[model samples]
Target: MLEKKSEFTIYPITVLQDNIVWVWVHNCNAVVVDPSISEPVEKWLLEKNLSLKAILQTHHHDDHIGGTQKLIKRWPQAKVVASKKELKRIPFQTFSVGDNDVFHLMDSEIKVIEVNGHTNNHIAFYISKEATKYNILFPGDTLFSGGCGRLLEGTPTQMFESLCKLNSLPKSTKIYPAHEYTENNLKWALTLEPTNLSIIERLKLIQNKLQKGMTSLPSTLSEERKTNLFLRAENIDKFTMLRRHKDSWKC
Candidate 1:
């Protein structure tokens, strides 16, 4: 039912609990990112009559790549793009890529960024096109709206470095993280910095959007710099401290 008139556009399909499967569409072709399941995505693509061009897997987590095999069954020719370092973990990847690797798809340039934190070999996709107004980042679970992913397979140092790399992107870059954790993240930030006007204001706006059943994502990098505490950390110690606090945080 979604319109397909745009030269390029990204749509979010909220699946499972808070996971968001981002579908990037250009003309009649579609590329799904971190599809948690195949039913809804299959239904949506079938309804729009869009051809599945590929599926971008950020990591090997079940919630991220669970539906990939099923989707590939539906679209036999659709390529599975994933980190080359994760071949053992993500065996379905047909187009294996590594850090700094660049490729063209859907008339846009995609740069692979190896951001290991939530999981070793986790990677993010950065999309840029001369025709688009702004760039896009499909950061999977490594970066969120108001927080960063917990250090699971990698160390604090790795996560800190990963966030710095993302922060270096153009401020206008729109972030499409793989989960709908904006509201909860902002609330947690507010608890830490109660007087932060940026956090308070963004929380109100995000709450309103969620109340209306709208996603509070695809947030610009500039907005994240203003409110994401993890991004504001100046050093590894600070970043580590914030991560520990967030892990133990109840709210």
Candidate 2:
């Protein structure tokens, strides 16, 4: 028997206010997730001498799909993968997918998970059983580091169910959420759970990372399970209450 090899490299390109455009590189090909702009991603890919293979869109938000047109013009053959239901919103999609759809990309299997919370047709990509050190999840705006997405289009119950779907994944999954809201979210959590040691310790570590101009995302499932109030909610009602409170709570 031979040992499998890990060949993928995920790069986090922080763009806009809090959005993070994730670039997954394999060999000489690369795939970008939720590009808020084109110049930075185009420049980065050009500098690395990597050709764009695809652009994976998790939702139809302007921030998530803003750079797709420009990026595709630079690499005409590069596939634009987005939600099939978002055709009107994301018109550049060459490969439109739906819930439970599985596709191979960069030598890894990508599973589409429909999570309706921030949006009605939002989806999260999951790559499990990889030879890499950990599994990967590009959860978009659904699940954040210390919190989840705001209930914009979907209801509290919908968001809660969506979170439950994500929480069902393995604890080793490395979450690559779209935004850099971990620090702020954790701060909010601390206010609600001041006595919780896990929240306190996580906040301290996140503060240190911020001080060094670092991102505190890509949180593990285990870490989120322990500290994320949304994920820890026992039922839909509890999740609803927490969401409502967080929505109005100030930092």
Candidate 3:
């Protein structure tokens, strides 16, 4: 996940509970994803003298879009991008997008992927540039490092299909999930597969990061394929069972 100085750098700003606000930086402009709060993000941008180019909303969850309005108040020109189908829920969206819609921003192309499961219209943003070595996926509360989002508003079949859609992406893609849930997800996975060495090693490495006060994310699809139980689920039935088990799991 190390990068040579490039035109873009997307990283996380950890916030309430486990929510992560992903800020994509390109030159002097910044695009924020799912800002759970505005004060810290606004302060950070102002300190760095970066203009808010846009705000990408993945869903209507309060924790996800809670800061959009407030953020726009400071940078009125910053576009609010969200699901076109959820206009009532996300009324402030300046640019509406749907599944598979491709848009250009900050000199890079972004693909809007409808990953509806955590919520009916939940979406993930993917960015792939010829100038960068790795692609980026900002899966808002949909695909976590070691798990998938809870099916709060969609069926298990819906969530399974969504995960499959994501799994088909190139393995080198870097996933910036909306929460620091890797440690907990891996811990639960270990309970199901006690001898899984991949899970064991990842849990250890992630624990080290947590201990040092770092976010254990920006995981590659390659790493998830090796250790993420949900991603490895062979069928919808298997995925559903794992989802149920994870829902009751305490970690």
Candidate 4:
């Protein structure tokens, strides 16, 4: 579904296979999250006549930060918000934040959540309910619609803990992940629980959305609690087993 433009709206720009560049718009200003490339994002902003406000970098991954430098070049005054620990990797950050650090942006309070799993020092941005109708989470690569990020540089235990941190958020929170992997992740979940009606129904709904060229994202925490296996995992052992299975399993 297309997000309605109100006082503030977040829109998705699909690029580079599954990468999603999320743009948060308020008035004539915009904040982009994890831009994989510059051309399309720049064109979109220019066409909309929106002035770039800042860029939220969830991690230092090349795909996430690749377009940042160019975007900042176009909007020279725009701030680059990223983890303080990733200074070496993401040298462009003008606003460095640490875990639990609260900061204000676009008239809303943003809480930094350090969720190291996809990579060490990986972080997620959490906007409290005071910011919007519902709380918002920009999980970058740490969390997806139906799955958690791969254990690229962090341990399975760390990944499990990271997901737990995300899970602790209010059920009404809307999750905006960096990639469009809901359908594939749900399909993988079905293999483990073929009789699970929640996963079954969610997969069908996500498939319909994808068929219509709509992104199956911005999923609510409540919806994920019911369908996402990683979030449902009770312990590190279960999470590790599922993560390993998913890594080796093919569609």
Instruction: Give the candidate number with the greatest TM-score.
Output: 1
Candidate 2's error at 36, in angstroms?
0.8
Worst 10 residues of 2 by lDDT: 1-10
Better of 1 and 3 by lDDT: 1
lDDT (Cα) of model 4: 0.92
Report the number of the highest-lDDT candidate.
1
Reference-based TM-score of each model: 0.98, 0.96, 0.97, 0.97
Residue 7, candidate 2: how far off, in angstroms? 1.7
lDDT of 4 by residue, 1-251 (tens): 23335567899999998999999997788999999999999999998889999999999898999999999999999999999999999999999999999998887789999999899999999987563566899999998999989988999998899999999999999999999999999999999999999999999999999999999989999999999999999998999999999999999
lDDT of 1 by residue, 119-162 (tens): 99999999987776669999999999998898879999999999
Pairs that collide, model 4: none
Model 3 lDDT per residue over 1-94, tens place = 2333447887678889888999888778899999999998998888778899999999999999999999999999999999999999999999
Residue pairs in clash, model 1 = none
After TM-score superposition, the amount by which residue 155's alpha carbon in candidate 2 deviates from its true location, in angstroms, is: 0.9
Candidate 2: segments with Cα more than 4 A from true spot = 1-6
Clashes of each: 0, 0, 0, 0
lDDT values for all models: 0.93, 0.90, 0.91, 0.92
Error of 3 at 246 (Å): 0.7
Residue 174 shift from truth in candidate 1, angstroms: 0.3
